[model samples]
Structures are given as structure tokens and as C-alpha cells.
Target: MANASARANSVTVENQDVALLKSTTVGRGPISDIAVDGDTVVTTNFGDDSIAVLDSDTLAVHGGVFAGQPTTVAVVGDRAFAAVSSASYDAIAVIDTVSGEVVKEYPLSFNVTAVVTSADGKRVYAGRSGEEGVDVAVLDVTAERVGTIYVAKAADATIDAMCLDTTGRRLYVGVTDSRSSRLITVDVETSRVRRTLEVGAPIRGLALGMEGVAYVLTSDIADGGVLYVVDLVNNKITADVAVAAAPTQLVLSADGTRAYVVDYDHVAVVDTEKRAIVAEVSVGARPSAIALGSDRLYVADYDGGVTVYTVAASTPMLYSQFASALAVPAPRELQPAV
Candidate 1:
């Protein structure tokens, strides 16, 4: 049983020809989302109802927590919040980084799809795809459920992905529909829809930039894929970039000058300023999520592994390597930043 569980957690990739950094698998399930803070990597295990905490520098499994069917994770200071979804348990699991134990669970009306923490580390905002209404729930880390904002027209809307600006005052949610899609921005304080930008497709992934610029990924399940860049200040589509088949996730660089996208079998890089495809690299099968570190991009593949790419140099190169390692740790220790 332990070997089977380990195999289920391991991820294997093809030879990338270059010296690749040994990839590490930290949990026993599909990694739906990943977030990084210094040497810590927080992952949402969609298949296991848990969050796997990993040591970024060594790629070692530190610890994790049974945070329900965690779909997303966000960290601020010594507190980590996970958006958990399940019929039996739908809530946000809050973990004190110093102890790694679940200090509290904020219940929700619907299944949680994404979660983001405030810059000040005082509040957590969660997006839910409810049966009756699509809404955003705000929780006070020190207190309990203090407020919630529901989107009426977005009641039946499916919010799969989200991102916040530097200030954490505004939230951008990606609404995916069968016929069309839209981007909904909400004011956290009032819990009201500040604006809804209608883009003409199914938007599954979202990324926010510095000057109110938003990047939206539209999935073309039948054909290839397309990326829509929206000017939030002006509320219009700025540019559209095409990508590989079935694009699933998107991430913007720290400088907000480039966008990285993951598709079924390839990763696309776009120049945000020029709004053009700059490079494309072949990766694992069915890449699900991506996270940006100081100079590298980490991709989680559905085949049970992760691929790390070096993006710092002028020409993007496949650095280290890949491996099949899996062993998600439980959340127990929360180390306060020094």
C-alpha cells in the first residue's frame, strides 16, 4: 500500500536533453495549484483532500494538512489558507505556519475553487462555485466569517481560477461557461462586483499585472487555444495570443513583462509588452498548473510529476532534469519569517 501510494504520488517526464534539476513530488494526488514563498512551496492536492508543504530549496516534503479536497492555496506571513471542495467538507482550511496544524476552517455555501490572502495577512478571500449562487467569501484570520459578497448573474457561474493585484483590494475571478466567459472584478471590502468584462469564450485561468492589466486564458478543447489580454483600467481586450491545444493555466512574471502558459503538452511564453508568442517548450503530458519563482517556472503535470524550467537567462533553457518522487507531508509546523 505504501509503494502504491508512492507511485501514485510520483511524476515522470521525458528526457529534456539539458541538465535538469531533479523534480520532486510532494503529495499523493493531483496537484491542482502551487504557491511559493521563499524556501517553502505550498501545493493543493485535489485528489487527496490535503495540502502538501515542500521545501523549495531541497525539493523535500516538509509537511502537509488534510484541508479537504484542496483546489487552491495562498500564503501570507505565517498563515496559509487552502480552498477545499467536497460534498462532505467545503471550507477554507487555515494553517498556522509555525505549528502546521489547522487552526480554523471557514465554512462556505458552495465548493471553493480559489483562495487569496490579503497583503497585510489579516484576511482571506475565497471564491465559490455554489449550486445556487457564485460568490466570494471574506474571512478575518483573527476572527470568523465577517462578510460575503454574492454575484447575482454569476450565480450559476463557475469560477475556476483567480488572481489579485498588489494591493489586495481588488480580486479578479475567471468565470467559465459552456457558451461564453467573463472576468469579474470584486471590491473586497464591499463584496460587490465592481465590473464584469465579457470575453467571448470559456476563461479558465487568470493572472493580474501591475498597471491594472489582466491576462485571461481561453480553452479551445476542440481546437488549440487563445489568450486574451485585458486592460482593466480601460476595460477592453488589448491583445490575443494563440497557444497549444487545451491551455489550462497562466502565470505572469514578477516584473509583469511576460506571461507563461501551460497547455496539454507544451508551455508557451508571451511578451506582455509586445503581446506575442516568444517561445514554446514541450513538457509533460497534461500540464495542470504553474508557479513562478525568482527566475524559474514550475509546472505540475497530471501524469504525477513536476517539470522545472529555467527562465532567467536571455534564452530560456531546460536546466536540471526530471524525476518520479512522491511523498506529501502533513501540515504541522508553521515557521515564522525571520
Candidate 2:
């Protein structure tokens, strides 16, 4: 009977293809960011000022909370941190993922553009950019504002996107300059600028990969676009690959072997080791953000809708079982615990 059970399990797994996973509309509005933690998928809606929580295994919208023009969202343990824009509240709202309620809101001196949590999930770094100045505020979740790092030279720079390395010791900030885009590396503990590398054109999105490697998507929004590979150790551009027109966002795979770039109306896969284009998947319409799960790639398109792609070494297939499995019953009441 044990052997028969093992055989049946193998057959069930064989029939489960990654491609079978359908991309469901977990929430409305333009998704600014999508983060997956265990079985939960949290998406920031820039259009509706809310954060939608979906079950990764079922693709069902478990619940959502009004987060106020949330431009970026990051999950560390049970807490979900959202960077609300100045147009809304100019603050970072903390939501409890388990209860789907706003537990705290940290008001910023300026517009908060991005928020990233530390590796150990003890602290959060919020980036504020506007007429006031470009600064990164460090928040101790257990306490309050412990310190603030001001990018004096970047006062005129528009801080757009930010990402941290695996160690959480280093942070890469994407700043838009008058003529080009600058990738600035900051020491998280010291909160000081370590290095600045310039990309010829303005960057719309940036992503950091393993081993101190950074990828920048140059979006001139007029002429064309390009992708620059930067080596953090040497603080230089190792390679530059020209991409499709108006590339918006860049996402790296889990292994850091490849990078997925969203252009005007398509998604291009780049081989990071070789620094070359490997596969160009036509997504149609403008793609907003790209996220990668265990073996699937999720693309949030501007108009065409979200698309999920199956990625694997052998016999790649999209699985939709997770989407349907996400329909857990909502709680009777969602209220602030504190």
C-alpha cells in the first residue's frame, strides 16, 4: 500500500503543470508592487490607494486594506509595510497581514516613495523624495525613528526605486537626474553613500541581484531604452544591453541567472551571466511590474492585464491550482487590534 501511495503521488505531481496556474485578478487598479511571503501574496494598488492580499496557493483575494496611494509594499514576517505617497498621506503605513488592518502609520517629512525591510525583519527603511529633499528614514519597528539619512547631493534628485542586498547591509537607490539616472549605494547601518554609478539615461526601475550585482532599466521615455549591468564591487558598468522602447521595470530571477525586463509592450529575458537577451516574451501593452515565484513569472501589464508564465528547467508548465485554492473564507470582522 505504501508503494502504491508513492506511485499515486508521483502521478499527481506529474499531472500538475506550472502553466495550469491561471492569473486571476486578485485586486483592481494598477499594481505597483507584488511581494510573496510563504502562502501570501501582497500587492500595492497605486490607483486605489489600497493593498490587496491574495493567497499564493489559491490566487483568491483574501482581503485588502486602504493604504493610501501605496507606491511600494514589502512584507517582513507578519507585518506589511507600505509607502504611501504625498498625494495621499506622505507616510508609511504598517499593516498586520494576518488580520488585514492598519496597525501603525509613520508620517514622513516628505513623500515616501519606497520602503524596504531589513533581512532580520527588525527595522524598515523608507525613502522620501520631493521638493523637500531626497532622504531615507530608518524606522525601528519596535521603537520609533532612530535615525534619518539625508542625500544632500541628491536633494534635486528624484528618488524613485530602492532595493537591498541579501545581507541588508547595502542599499541601491535609483535616482532620476536631469540628464541621466544614478544608482547610489548606501550603507544601511551607517546611512552613508558608498558609491554612485551613472546610467546614461534616466532609470525607471532597478533591481539588485546576488553577489553585489545591480540591474538598471533606462527609460528615456522618448528616444529608446537600455539595460546596464553594474558590478557593485568595482562600481562600474560591466555591460550594457539595449532593450525595447520605453523599458519600465526590471526583475531578476531567484537564482540571479536571468533578468526579466518589461518594455513598451513586451517582456525580455536577459541572461545575467552572459549579459545577453535570451528570450523575448510578447506581453502586449505596457508592463508595470514583474515578479518571480518558485517556478512562475508574474507580469502586471498596464492595459493587457496580468500574465503568468511558466519557468523551469524541463517541461515548464503554468499551474492554476494555487489560484483556485486561494478562496479561503473571509473573517467575520476586520478591525484594528490595537
Candidate 3:
């Protein structure tokens, strides 16, 4: 059924109100994580033991491969590392984006919940949450497992989210307990916690922007949810953007002016400078993952479907000083690994 809809040729959905570029079904349901590079789109189907791959240029499905219980994914160059953390085992499935096949796997003792890789595809950083203090597993592409980088304390702390900056030199780790949360910056070269910022709520998503500006999404029982704008350069929370009661995911636009957040049944577009929700796109099903690439918004839902949109945000494109960063970069094509 869902695959049948995707099996058919793609059709564009556009209206005066909704700028839907296209929509298609990937697999069964409940996509947990999604990653996009220059030429491909990959989603971890937590609803099943597989990951779906799609062609970025044509929006065509390239099928997928079995990845066990993949909870998170990070794409670098031609390879995509998916964190598989089922009760039976724990590993990272290295996938070839072009062939849609799992080429390799790196086994680990700790369960990886979130993963991100360097630009060169040489190193993979995985976030592990468990009884011990939260730690990041550093794995080499050629050597498998290498070492660990500790980030938070052990008193019931969990790694909620993690993001690598553009330079690939700095990492932002988000750790949360029942009542408190902290954002820790890790220096990748030395593997040390450089700075820590206290957050009032549980961190759900982490995204880095231009000029050391980080958008951290959090959820609170009393305050619902907020998109905390953190000035990493100054080490402070600049603004609190009230998004919704439970925002699950976040992605920033290529222009660095807008941030798209998944708020239950809708995707809220935020103005980074003004620190506000400027627009909300209502989805048919509850959204589980969201990503942006080359001016298109890709949203995965609980119904095993993905809707791509050519979002026309009402907010300003970028900060006046960063006007030259307006050109959107094309998706990276998966090439043969040397």
C-alpha cells in the first residue's frame, strides 16, 4: 500500500496556501531519523528494520536495505552511518547511498541513540545513553571502534541530541535528566568538554547556524516547548521561542534565517533573528523527522510517508551581514569510495 503509492511516478502537489513540492511513501511507518547530502535522502524506518534511500534530484525511490532497529542516521559523502540499537544487539550499519545496500557494520557494547559524522566520512561520533554517564563513541571508518568521549554525569542522564558544526572541529552535545538539562560543547581534536550551558528544559534537537548561533529545541512540562536561541559566541540563551507543547525535531534552512521544527501534526517555521514562529504547515499525520536540502523541506510522518515542500517563508532570508550566504548548495552525489 504505502510502497505502492511510492512505486508510481511522482506527482507535484501545490496550492495557493501550501507550497507542497512532492509527497511519497517510503515504508511502513514511524521514521525515526533522516539525513540528506548532495545527492541522496535516507530515513531510518523505526517502524521496521530498514532504511529507505531516495534520489535527491528526481525524488525517486532507490529502495533500501535491512538495518535492524536503526534509531538515528548521519550521512557523509557516499556513506551513511545508521545507529542500530535493538535489545538483541547494538551496532552501526554503514550504508552505500548509491546502491542502497549496507556495506559494513561496526559492533559496540553501548547502545547508540544518535549519530553524526565528519565531512570527510572518516570519523563517526555516536551518542550513547544508559545507566552510566552519557558518552560519545568515536569510531573510525577503516578501524571500526576507536575510543569514547565522556560528556555528562551518571545520575540518570541521557544524551538527547548532538550536532557537528560546519567546520567539523566542534560538537554540541545535549544531555538531560528528569528535571535538568545541559548543552556541552566538545572539542573534537582534543576530545574535551570546552563549555557547558544550562538549559531549562529537556533538549529534543540541536542545530548549528552561521556565526556560532545554535538553535536548541526543548520541551518542558510547565512551559510546553521552546526553541532556545543560544549565542555560543557569548555562552547564553538569547531568546526563548514558544513553539508548541511537544516539538520533536528541527532543521535550519540553507540561508540560515529560518528553522523548521516538527510540532506534532504541524511543522513550524521560525525566524531566527526575530526568534519567533512565523509560519506553520499542517501535516496529515504526526511528523517524526524533518530535514532541509537545496530549498526543499522533507518531512517524515508516523504513517510511513514523506512530504517534500518548496517552502516560501515569510521571514527574512538571512541576517543582513550574512547576505552573501544566500546561494543554496546542491546535494552531494554519492561517488565510488577510493
TM-scores, each model vs. reference? 0.81, 0.80, 0.86
Global lDDT of each candidate: 0.67, 0.67, 0.76
Q: What is the per-residue lDDT of model 1 for residues 1-338, given as tens digits with 9 covering 90 to 100?
A: 01323333322233232223446655565788887765666777777666776666665666777766777788766677887767675777877665667887776666777777665666676777766757666676654534666754544678767776655556788777656788888775456688888887777678876666788888765646787878999889988877657887887776667788877766777777777777765543556788777666676766545656566433322211110121111112222211
Model 3 spans > 4 angstroms off:
1-18, 312-338
Which of candidates 1 and 3 is the stronger one according to lDDT?
3
Model 1 Cα displacement at 171 (Å)?
1.9
Residue-level lDDT of model 2, residues 127-178, one tens digit each, is 7775755877777766454357666454567777788666556778888767
Please give, for residues 7-62, the per-residue lDDT of candidate 3 as tens digits. Answer: 23232223232365567777887888888887788989988878988876556788
- lDDT of candidate model 3 versus the reference: 0.76
Give model 2's clash tally. Answer: 18
